[model samples]
Target: MHFSIPETEVRSDENGSTYVAYNIHVNGVLHCRVRYSQLLGLHEQILSDLYTFFVYEVRKVTKLFYFLPVVRQDPILGSSEMFNSFLRKAQQETQQIPTEEVQLEIYLFSGQKVKVNILTSDQTEDVLEAVASKLDLPDELVGYFSLFLVQERGDGGCTYVRKLQEFELPYVSITSLHSPNYRIVLRKSYWDTAYDSDVMDDRVGLNLLYAQTVSDIERGWILVNKEQHRQLKSLQEKGSKKEFIRLAQTLKYYGYIKFDPCITDFPEKGCHVIVGAGNNELNFHVKLPSDQMKEGSFKVTRMRCWRVTSSVPVANGTANPSSSSKCDVKLELAFEYLMSKDRLQWVTITSPQAIMMSICLQSMVDELMVKKSGGSIKKKKRLNGSFQRSDSQQAVKSPPLLVGAEVFTKLSSVSLRGLSSSNSASDISGNDFHGNYAFEGIGDDDL
Candidate 1:
């Protein structure tokens, strides 16, 4: 709920009118952009509203009213400092607001939805547990499920999907963004499916895939030689849905970049680079016909910056020489090592690889930043990179909230029942709950 008025930048429109654009960051995340005119209008609105509220009091023949200036005679309210001061006051007022219940629409992967009321200040874990109970998930099976906030963008637009991590911010605040189109989806088998399968089938032939020696298959790196490429193509031709799903479900934090160190300099040699993340470090290795070995890598904590550059197609040997407009964009990723700030280590990767690497690096950096800031790391306890399942029983005996039922009706029923029982203290606010039930566009909704 924090707000900040950061530095403004000069921007121009198509009509050539330039204005100062303010960057409004909320809790370190970019919320929205506002122009100088918007700030002026905001100040005017605040002044008008406040003046209207105090007009009658100011008109009294009281000593306090004598010192009050008329609206027309008041000091200017549309300055940068005035706008900032108003924002600061507003931020302080927002913190004083009491925590209230917020209704969240929980969407299931099977396209069904159930509504649940949760407090705004409730932690994400509490919301998840409530969701799990609503979904009829047993204690043992609940570990496989995870919640994701889905922002459904307009048709053909990009949809943003964010996994609700255990240590994430409160559930209510995250849903407030794009509220109309936002939904909390319950995804089953949400953990790393590939790793889970590998663990379960460790005694099988897949063991070769995770072998330690260079001659054997490496766990994280993908072998992209001609033989494997042919094998993948053959598997594709066979078109077995199970096999395809197995291949596609093999997840990697850092995507495999196939590159050959010896022939990587000569683009015509068809080299590739394979990369992986291990123990807070980025592992870059080269896969060759005869031998596979580590090329080079650096700990993510040691990186200060990541710079990317694009090159002309002609310079890259992979591009077709005859067609000038051919798809031949070669991307270069450069890392500024903290220990050696004077020089940067760079690598050539395709556009897709560059994007994947950037995403992985950014995620790692964000986590490292959190750790450096001394935020508690509440990672799920794991044995060999896998979570250990808990065997405790779930408290709920029956479905807490019935699906396809009106939320208010169910809540009212429970509150009334609890009032008659000995558990009256555990019920929601007796008469206040019904009065405070505020639903946005709830009339047309069936539940």
Candidate 2:
């Protein structure tokens, strides 16, 4: 069967043979090939070969992703023993690189990895001594100098630096340090950690979080007032112990600060902050029980933040017990509230808030996939005798390789993600059929 494609020019050879070569992008990936044959009559052979090459290119691209993030985050994996084992197993499974040849290829590719060379400067001994004394100097920070360090080859030749006795050259500027001279050519991402040319696929949510910041939120909120405190004091004065507790809870819920009840008999829930932590402030853990708790006790359950009147419904439609609302809600509410008001505890996000922005991107991708698969709500029309109820069933009837491409790409990408870093969870969650989030973290750490 023929696939629809743009018109292209083709010319016949002297022997009456014809050839045409061009590029087609599938799922944000590309492949290039030129073909020649006696007669190209919807040639099934070409389709098969094209699919083969398509899969290979996809594997290579995905391999870059799988290996890249791992190397970046986990230093253990970057060690020679582990890296060499990885090469051995990968070559065996894919046969893309022969096991015997993997070392040479990896070395050849070493040039692309961040490199640094520390050449012997005048009176290099002191510099070498200082560098040697510096703990955990990664070759990426000082690899180019690896050459300068060695008087002879031991095991990995010039590429391996673990055996070096000292930093090869002192006075060579470390490209990474604030201003230390150690001539380091490390991957910019290793130091930069913010942007990567390889990671733009994740551009969506980051754009929004960057656009919105703390200052924007502060403008919208009104702080807790004296009247509310006055009302609370009236309850306390009347000896309405329960009423005072309830109001205290209300104030806390609204983001007003609350000290733990000082009564010795009360079972602790959370330690009281000896010093009040600022709104959304990342409070440090004291060696002692929190001031919020009894002198030696901890809170059994954290008191809800007084500031959040609302929270977003979860993706699965479950409401957080801490939130007042039960309905599925937009996450933007929490963000907006935090930005607008003061006096509620600070939001403790481990990473940049830009991640939430990517959700809209995910939705957009899902929509595009639905469109690409042919609009919502399929009109029930049958052609010939080959109708099927699901794409999975339809896939059963397509050519084996064509149907398998989905699996091939997924199998290659998932294992890397599932096993990698703290980011493994995000990798799996963000990877959808449209390939929108595939390589985003490959280049940068949101952390």
Candidate 3:
């Protein structure tokens, strides 16, 4: 059983009429044909839903299909198909690696210590093989981080640690999700990898081979605790005492859950915000200039949404019903968004909710921006106290800012064939592999 799908091309006409066409051959039979007009994003969702059906059908037969999707030609992979494909591929069984791509955030502490956060659409294997191949770090412990721990169809589906401590002092410690700040903080001094790659091109903080980071999401380092995690119990249906208590601790310890007012330094035109987790499935807030936000007068007030996830209705008190005054600026959130690389595109809503979502995403953004040369230069003179490094790695350079879709395009374009492919089960193990794999999903069609 094999699934071979032709690369699709979707484009809109001057009239804004979008057309999409693709062909799929399953088991050498042209079984499905997909055609749609406009709404490429929605079309990807429908295609992903189709994948679930196909996966079930394939499993019943031989379970040896490629589910081949031509690399590059499909915009659906990024605009919408990404999440859906990830869910389906995680359950796939075959020698071929699924098209799902994993995104990660690596935090570099001064000295030798480091922390990495892995974010992937597919939750299959858990080693930082692809990452390690790019970096010069020793392969002792490859950590995994997630809000939810998945039992590998085995191990009761509980989460565990995979760490490597071969390096000298100030080396990395692995912990998943929110490991309640358990490790000892030797000193407040810290050195961060540049948020923008161009910042220090000459300085390879961690000499990387496959360290092809698509983008830097933010700045500040993450806080994780290991001892508290080791003591917790695993309870409920697929539950872990260590992980949950750790999450609660992270929220309280950081006072991150506490409310903060919305503030920013940029114009409200190209600006937007998200609330909750970094995933795009969350809510959104769009800030308009006093002139564009015509829902009456634009007042400088936070707006809350009717729903926790969606901004369906606008809560009152954010703006005047007249188009006279404009809303004041909350530019701070925009700077914060540099941390998480804006993988998720939140939905739009009213006052406080808009403010809340903006508050969260911006923090991530700001963190990353500070790492870039341009960002670092702006703050170099002002940064003070323990959080600052001696002669920060901001001497490199900075690239121009691009839209979210463009960033994805750049990432997908990088050849993954550089990473070793999966090996036979005989050699199957954690964090070890030997093969060449080219990541195919979007951006580059020549592959």
The clash numbers for all candidates, in the given order, read: 7, 38, 76
Best by TM-score: 1
Over the stretch 1-447, how does candidate 1's per-residue lDDT look in tens digits?
A: 112332346667779998665544332233344665655565456556556543443344132111111221222221123343444333323333346887767765334676767776554556766776665544444444456555565652223244453323344345436367776665432222333343324232222122211111233234445665465557657844345335434433322322222223211233454545443445554444445443555555444444333332443444221231323334444444422323333333443244334434544443333333443222233444223222211110111111123321111111000000011111112221001110111111211
Mind giving the per-residue lDDT tens digits that candidate 3 earns over 189-265? Answer: 11122222222222232222012110110111123345533332222133442334234334212212212123222
Error of 1 at 248 (Å): 2.9
Quantify all predictions' global Cα lDDT against the true fold.
0.38, 0.23, 0.25
lDDT of 2 by residue, 311-403 (tens): 223446443322222232111101111111121122221111112211222222222333335533222223342122345222111111111
**Which portions of model 1 show Cα errors greater than 4 Å?**
1-98, 138-147, 161-171, 186-194, 198-247, 250-447
Q: How accurate is candidate 1 locally (lDDT)?
A: 0.38
The stretch of ten residues in a row with the least summed lDDT in candidate 3 is 297-306
